[model samples]
Target: MGGSPHTLCVPAGCSSSDDYTVPDALCGVTVGSEPLAPLLPDGEKSVCSVSVDKKQAVYVTDGVTDAETDPVAVQRDALARMGNPQKAAVGDDARIADQGGVAVGVCTYQGRRQKFVTLVDLTSNHPVPKRTADRRKALESFLRAYLPKAMEAKGCRK
Candidate 1:
């Protein structure tokens, strides 16, 4: 797939959490494989944006049934990921827009880290109140593949 320079990529061996090396600057990233569902249309994806550093980890999902994710809880978890008892930061509003049937979520863990953005596609079927475990896996996979590129991209962020 062709995209702008800011388009990031995740690395291999990121199938699990402990295997990931959080970007020194950007902790946010898009993870997952392509849609595995026969009913799901091509091009659209169940995107999840995860920002994790040595200080914290933030997981955001869109195009799923759970938009009720508590930012406070996420912040706590993110901090725990880095073994930091203090909460670093949390995006009060994190989501992907369903643009004309294409659902996409983006997360830019700016300020706390360096500068980078992770865009995830959840589905082509607009926003709905439902989620599946498969989608979660897809998100993790995609982010694991591309988070590093986003975090390390120089001159991409403002």
Candidate 2:
């Protein structure tokens, strides 16, 4: 948390200069590629980093060079797309919009601080479809493979 946030573009020798270590493992988990593959454009790999502090944590990933949106902003926009209501449940107090990219989850851990926000944002270079039904379905499929391990890595609990 002491250092500035940095982005890394893998295979291009980009470095993550932030205080946090990039959780590259998020990209290589056993999740089926079918759900995530189409969401990404051509010739991009799923790379990710975790930027975390005491009260919040964000795990963002994409197939491109850098994240185009902040996790909080992505969360807000995706939620707004759902008419600003807390919909869809993925265990814990998590809400995932049906538009296919951002999820907000509340994690509880035993400490002076009892809760924190764990945001998962899957940014894409390609524009999302206007209908979003297909994208939403794909996102849910991808999260089934990505979310549990990501939360564990973030030291979050349901």
Candidate 3:
């Protein structure tokens, strides 16, 4: 195999939580809502918009609520609402709700102590039923597309 050896990157001085820096803005991450099409109406096309709140740690698309105090708390709350979330093979740590309406992904970036957390919600208007395999897959697909871009923007090793 003709390939270059890649060196493993380890964060320096990563002992304290304060050493990690959270991303101030996520609007720079380029992502489309196309992966989310299946979650919406057949004829409807939804545009993904980032919240401009400076308090938010990452780019929170429309459907996702901005983190007010703690991102980890937000993640815990989202997972709680999911009832039962299936582990996703997306980012560092990810979970997709059984109903396919909610998905949360977490990725740790280089030089930042704070991990980038993202949430996708499709159950805003109505309650999503349980055990929706297809919907869960769709949510997984969306995270597949969204997480990489967001991670790259945050300077994660590809």
Candidate 4:
């Protein structure tokens, strides 16, 4: 988008004739002149125009997506892959935690299997650990049920 006009300011109390032409990089683009062509219409084509401010507000670029590496789905998948639930702990994998922060956590069982969960915290810094024995079992069951659904919702799993 075109920017605002460049101004050449004279020294304090100095006349315009005494002002120096600032470097092009320092001075902004001139205003009220014809805008560069791609922005303008060519030939008989009807052109629709929006102001720079309005254009900025209306337009945006598309984002990229990945299936296996979607943070939340990956975490759930990783946890399911690990198999054991008792050994799971928060912030276990430096790489995943670094990428997703507390949005990821690991759950290990009997030190044999591990599972990861993502987006367990919408805002909190830590996942709420299952404390009691029965609660842990319940939590594990909940993860098994919910993880697949969460992955599917993110379009990361079939």
Pick by TM-score: which candidate is best? Answer: 3
List the candidate 3 regions with Cα displacement exceeding 4 Å. 1-28, 32-34, 43-74, 99-110, 127-131, 156-158
State the lDDT of candidate 2 residue by residue for 1-158, as single tens digits. 11222333444554433323234354454444344443333221223422233322223442211123334454576566543334445433345554344443444444322333334443432323333565565555556556665555555554
| lDDT (10s digit) by residue, model 3, range 94-153 | 777753323333433444344556676554433222226766776787677776777666
**What is the lDDT, from 0 to 100, of the residue 120 in candidate 1?**
41
What stretches of model 2 exceed 4 Å from their correct place?
A: 1-24, 27-35, 44-78, 81-86, 98-116, 120-125, 128-131
Which 10-residue window in model 2 sums to the lowest lDDT? Answer: 49-58
Score every model by TM-score: 0.27, 0.46, 0.52, 0.24
Residue 60 of model 1, lDDT score? 29
Residue 42 error for model 2, in Å?
Answer: 2.9
Please give the TM-score that candidate 4 achieves against the real structure: 0.24
Clashing pairs in 3: 20-113, 21-113
Alpha-carbon lDDT, every model: 0.29, 0.42, 0.46, 0.27
What does the lDDT read for residue 10 in candidate 2?
A: 43
What is the RMSD, in Å, between candidate 4 and the native fold over all Cα?
22.9
Q: For candidate 1, which ten residues in a row score worst on lDDT?
A: 96-105
**Sort order, TM-score high to low:** 3, 2, 1, 4
- Give one digit per residue, the lDDT tens place, for model 1 in 1-158: 22211112265433433333323232332222232221122221123222222211233232211334443344344324322232211122222222111121233334322223333433233211124333344334444444444433422322
Report the alpha-carbon TM-score of model 1 versus the true structure.
Answer: 0.27
